[model samples]
Target chain A: MSVKLAGELQSGNVIIVENNPVVVLKAQYNKSGRNSAVVKVRMKNLMTERISEAIYKADEKLEGVMLERKDCTYSYYAAPMQVFVDSEFNPYEIHEETLADITKYLIPDMTDVCEVTFYEGRPISVLLPKTIIREVEYTEPVVRGDTSGKITKTAVLKHTKHELQVSGFVEIGDKIEIDTETGDFKKRIA
Target chain B: MRRWDLFCRVVDNYGDIGICWRLARQLADHDGEGEIHVRLWVDDLESFAKLCPAIAPRSPVQAVGSVEVCHWSTNFPSVDPADVVIEAFACELPLTYIAAMARRPTPPVWINLEYLSAEDWVEDCHLLPSPHPTSPLKKYFFFPGFTSRTGGLLRERDLMSTRVAFDAAAEAVFWQSIGIPPRGNEDLRVSLFCYENSAVPEFLQSCVEGPTPIRVLTAPGAATEQVSRWLGRGLVTGELVRVGALAVHAIPFLSQDDYDWLLWSCDVNFVRGEDSFVRAQWAQRPFVWQIYPQDKDAHFVKLGAFLSRFLHGVSEPTVISDCWQAWNGRGRISFAWPNYVANLAEIRRYGEVWACQLDHAEDLANNLIRFVREQV
Candidate 1:
């Protein structure tokens, strides 16, 4: 169902645009000294694959979009697309183009549910978990008292039969959080 | 070519006005024959006058090179419409100017030149466009970045040549003329200028304890207060004190040109905030960056990204990394200082190479000319 916003939404706010819920990418707060504030929000249109930035008065209120989440199991990769089976055993396929950046984190039958974006009753995008536990392929041997500043090294990720190369310093067999959003290693989880 | 107007509100700092002045001068100088006429509207004409003595603050309008420097007032002037307009660092253009641009035949190339960043997404987001709802204006996002895909850093032609001809003896005489003493042989000459940072004490102690003497040239501001507190005595012009092996020299306030020379002359520069940081990079010397701290320590990520790219090929990467982290953390300065100094030669070479690479990027003025030509 199409949802209309009550007022203006700030940038970075996840909202319903048309029938699809999208995130506000940027918000410019324009107000002179002692003047009323106005917010100009730049939004990414999830369903149509376009971006539109609009301005609104600061006092304007925006309607929050309702997003639905469900438990799903990873089925298999079809070249660039990733397929997932929900609780009803219904298969939802996401194009490889959309999931290509975060595809390395998807492990089959792992039971981790994914967040799917729906617009106008059609899936538009997906949001991955902030951190994914992955095995470290390689890390330099840690030296004691050698906290020689800002160390960054590459590591590989091994998930069952799937092997992926990631960069960060962590020992082999160590599980670290890989932030799919930025493609940077967060930290060692366990 | 699109006619562009760059509005700079200099907030009393020479660096801010200095940068904007360079951008304006270069834009006008190079784009004279092109379709661009860059009208530089600055609030602080007095500060702008300090950089280029040719600027007559009394004159409401005066020409310096190709740039038309106007004494900016609250009331915007009515002028012919331009093809492009820029608001530096999100500074608000006069409402009248915006209204006029909205009334233009063809919408101007509106841009908000954002501060420099090293974050990963900046590459993708740089040069993105945003449309004005009420007006037909479409403002493009221009982010100054370390990477090539982004709008490059501001570096003027003859900057290197000017830096290269910096004579040490002449600099000493110039300082002496200003009543500052000659540099001590053993002192590690440093230029101190930054925002308030918690790590200042530890960093100071490390400099004090280091084998070589540290001669610090203090800028007026929080750094001046810091130097005063560290010495437990008020600083006067040309005052020198021996703390351990370090001989801290507090010099008088310098003009913008002298500041550039100081960066070129110093063994290491401790520069904080955006303007000095860019100047330090252009100096081609081994320097430590004290990033402006933010909530949630977001500056750490920016600092990390820059260090990772900056020290990518250095020998003994770990030592360099640790030193940078220690300085940034404002912890254990004693440990980091020695390692940093030992690799000074190599780091200097690396910095020079990096500066050379950055020089390859189009100067902001030249880029503006090219941008204006293509659009017009």
Candidate 2:
């Protein structure tokens, strides 16, 4: 167990609350008017897969549940669980509920190495690669004089059907790099 | 009676204790169904005494009205946790007290009552729960705000009606009570309560050179000192120093109730921090706020958020926003003052409209009661 301030805690970090190990899916820190700050987090329980949102003082000390993580590749998806295989072909089944966020970016046979976190050797969550390149399945035609990237329009990803904002210059079938954590367009692939 | 412990640590100004005391008194007065016996635990009683004369600084425990006030010492007393616990402004609760709370059969409804902000994020974060890491306890984050989604501003039950009933005769009495002569209609009366800022001299200079005769009442301590520095002379309580059209009077530090009266009596109010700022709004007067400055100019964002809400539907919002920015060290008060003063009538009328609009929000104390009832 390791101690971390609530403000320092980030996504993919597992924290112990009420004897349960919960992985943070997202964290947002906001400074109050004076002398204090607050951190709001969305987390999911490793054992029960119970998703919950909580707020904590930025300076609040929290116990982090250290978990073993292994680099793995997405192999397949069983009915209620997504399966990942390590280099040695060791299969780990993570609940589909736990993949609620990363599922949009998950693709079988993807070359990126995803990190699989385990508690007591039970696979809990998968951390996607920091940035992912995906082809824009569909978007409007490029608008004139929009090369400055000030304007943005929604574009749908090819395989995942995930729609995200892209620069106005981006057109259908254009590949863009997206920040996996925020799901924001990083840059357009030439 | 359902008991509550409101813990407040006075960091620098009286804003912390002022707000806590107001909430405690309001909660004590408006115990809707069951009695909510509020105990305000303050670290600095000397400061608390300034706001409420009834508070005995040396006493360990004393009752002021229905609320019980306790001196929160470094050596904390071993007391049972209340049914509901509020740590005001994120002041950490004593570890021993938290331990006692954890021992309770059904853990107390713990709340970290945050500072007031008009920012959009406040609504999303308000009333959210924070589960304790090791203990079987949860604390909720309650934020006071201008909107209905967030816990509203602090307002006493009779505050509005009381202000409305304070007629010109009552105003004359208030002036006499404060050692000031009756205010003439020609003199634009303004109350100044703020932290030290670079804009003070410029503001004072503007009043001195402006066409309108302005009478500035500087609240004791920092505000008075600032005015004195600008005057190149020390100020004594009740001493009026005249410079051109600007006449500055240094008033003694007043009780919380009297301070509210000061805001109500003023044509324009300059308020700082949390408590006085809220009171200025309830006063329904054209006011300039100097938000408690933070590192990296973060407070400007908060000020902008409030200005956006306050300036809604107003013609020429910059007239107010510019003066506010200048007062906050962003622009020149000399340039903004003319625009601000020229529109005082419009601003004053809008102040009434703004206060009435804010009235629609649930009062902070009542909001806490409804939230607590739902939880415990």
Candidate 3:
């Protein structure tokens, strides 16, 4: 399949650029008076694991690349490598750098199922669960007279040590659900 | 010397040809050691002739002023691409011509000129490159906007100076030639041009019952038809329809320069679309814009965004904002007319200041030439 016009381009789509498969990470589209629009994208090179930027006419067609996915469970992290085991007990090790932004949300020693994407027999990327429950490690007390949740404060996840912006009322040791893609706090479990 | 090819598709209106003609004229008239060559290919010569009278509607090729006007035909012609190829309004170039472009040792600098908008996001996307998915070519996106970060509005070299030196005697002669009598201070003059909207009937009623009398100079188009229907009478060119204090004159469409003078002479202006909207702003008068409505009220967002920037820091914005809103069918002009008329002085002065501020930004034609020079 092919995507024509950069205006329709979105993140998570795999597009072939110069014969190399690149995963779109971010796409920004701009339209002028009455002319053709433009799309600027930040992509990850699946072949070499390098990051690159491309800008193109929003209407230019791009050949798309399809990836195979396998359901896998995260086992543990060994220094710079994170290991996951598939249903058939095959172990796949992904480098910390290869994990890109998803490494911050991976729960070590947990059995959470993840979707591993493969391009030509090599694991290219991993998709985490939509929402994950975690314990808050630390957060400052809400300001006096500011009881509204509209104002947010930063808090850390206990096991992952990843920073998450939560409502003002969020306290230390609170169990909250977070969205992995948006990094937004979804709801409080406890 | 750089040669430029500007391709335009009429898209049911004369605006596409209007902007392209202006840019072509500007580039072809540039005074440089190496004169620039401009070849303009328009799909609809009839629409082009409406804005530019020099064009012979039936001719396949004609020398119209500084540029060579080519009546774009269905059959592709074998020709070499110019140093710069502009896809105006996203109307794609001929595949055969593009194939020719790719075969050249150094491909042309292709630029896709996008629509105009004041939204902050335009700045970030301006000048971004889109490479041909298969062909070894890259095209840049040029966005025309009010801010310095984006390509500026289209303004000719001597437009302001010519306006400054305009003779009042000549203006009076022009008015007589257009069949409109001289205006008195008490009789507020107005030029009406707009798209069809449901709110026009109420607007005409407000004008008829208003405190002061107004003489409206209207061109023959959707606006004239609407007003004729409201009065239950037929209106022909050079005829006037009078009811109570409102008098609507059916005037023929003037040429571009004459249209500018019309905007200048009027105390207030009602303009539409991208070309005349920008011209009205530069005319430095209190004007109302009837945005080309889009599906799902998308144009309202564009109207509101422009108003937010145009009315920034003004002490009172309701009279002007409400009037514009009413003109766009978001509100009622009849309800906002009294206050709008009362605050005309303030709005007129603010318009001048806004125009002055916009004049400081780089003009579109100049910016385009600079970009071309860099590429070629």
Candidate 4:
């Protein structure tokens, strides 16, 4: 179904804009007159993995792309493809290329109970939890008196190898909750 | 000089065609023309013909001056896309036409012209590209805004100079042509053009009982209908009705240019929608806007944004703001009119300075042409 009024488009709405599947990152509505109403949206192309902005009339209809979401658990990697299975153990294979940049966060054993999206019978992408707990892979010893995490120091995540910023008090063996969306360090647990 | 295909769908009334027609004429009337071709495809010719009298409502293709207006139907035939394809107001082009565009050795420069806005975000979204998934083609979003970063408002080459040279003698002749008797300086000569507003009856009542006599020139639409509903009779062209100090003379539907003249001659213009609102600005007259009501009180925000920006530096913003609020059903217009009418001198001067400020921004057609030039 078409999304009525571009103003109704919300974050996470998958729409076909310019024939490409895109997820709306943000939707902002601004009208300056009765007949002059518009909605400006920032969208990320699911295929090309590029961020772009577009404007639409407030009442303009947008074609939406429907995708099925399933709760799944990461099992193992089958070379260029990462394997996942549901609670019922129905196995699914998704291409490493399809996962795009998110593949770096796919810790096969630790990142469990993830959401996989199916489009036209193929797993196109994975939705990461807002926050995830990952063990620190490497970081220099905490700098003395640099206790405040407000200003972060660089640390790498175990298995994923994704670099994260954490407090100077954190050590290489510490486990920290990291926000997946912004990739910001949330809290540490020794 | 290149072929330009402009597509417009009349979503409401004349606004869509009015804008498309103006842009088409401006593009075709390029300086030192290298023989360019412009084709305007409109889905509704009846509404388009209302704005452009030269159009034949039933004709599939009608040549009006330098531009060819085509009646766009559902069964749109596949044709070669122009060097520049403008989908006005994001009216999606025909699927076949889009397919044809992608097949070209070099695809046409596609533009999705957005609605005009005074919002801050318009600047960031202007000229951003929407790359097509299936085809190796990209369409740019064009935002019409009050700022130079935007595509700017639609204006013609001679619009300002012609408005500047408008003669008082000619204005008097115009009043005579419209069956309006010579006016007294004390009488408030007003042009009433708005959507169906419930506040109008109260406004009429205010004009009737007010101390100063008022002469109203109204077209045959919402405002006129409201007046007629109050009078309990349909108002005909040239028919005059007087109740207390308020006297209204019904006028025939004026063409776009004549409408601008009407704004120019009137003491105040009550304009609605996009086209007339913009014209009211260029006319350099104190005007009140009755924005079209939206689904969820959205129009109020738009009204506020415009009012805040437009009246920011005016001498007495409160007087104008109070009247605008009253006009849009925020308060009783009767109470607001006394103070609003008192500040006419400031408003008129403010209008001139404001128009001068806006005149510096790039006009829509010129900006569009410049943007297209870089792409091709």
lDDT (tens digit, per residue) of candidate 2 on B1-376:
8999999999998988899999999999994798888999999999999889988999999999999999999999999999999999888899999999999999999999999999999999999999877789898999999999999999988888998999999989999999999988789999999898999999999999999999999998889999988888899999999999999999988998899888888999999999999999899989999999998888998999999999988878999999999999998999999899999999999999999998887799999999999996
Ranking by DockQ: 2, 3, 4, 1
Candidate number with the higher DockQ (2 or 3): 2
- The candidate with the higher lDDT, 1 or 4, is 4
Docking class of 3: acceptable
Best by TM-score: 2
Off by over 4 Å in 3: A1-8, A29-39, A45-60, A73-104, A142-165
Using lDDT as the measure, the top candidate is 2
Better of 2 and 4 by lDDT: 2
Model 4 - which docking category?
acceptable
What TM-scores do the predictions have? 0.69, 0.96, 0.91, 0.77
Clashing pairs in 1: A19-A120, A20-A119, A80-A96, A148-B322, A149-B321, A149-B322, B1-B376
lDDT per residue (tens digit) for residues B191-308 in model 1: 7886676667777887777777777777776777787787888876677777886666676666666777788888889887566888899999988887766655667777788888
Q: Chain A TM-scores, one per candidate?
A: 0.56, 0.89, 0.83, 0.72
lDDT of 1 at B319: 66
Cα lDDT for residue B137, candidate 3? 80
Native-to-model Cα distance after best TM-score fit, residue B191 in candidate 1, in Å? 1.1
DockQ of each: 0.08, 0.75, 0.43, 0.29
lDDT of 1 by residue, A66-183 (tens): 5455556678888767787777888777665555446677776555566665444555456666666777655566534444425655565666434443333356778877666666
Off by over 4 Å in 4: A1-50, A55-190, B32-35
TM-score of 1: 0.69
CA lDDT for candidate 4: 0.82
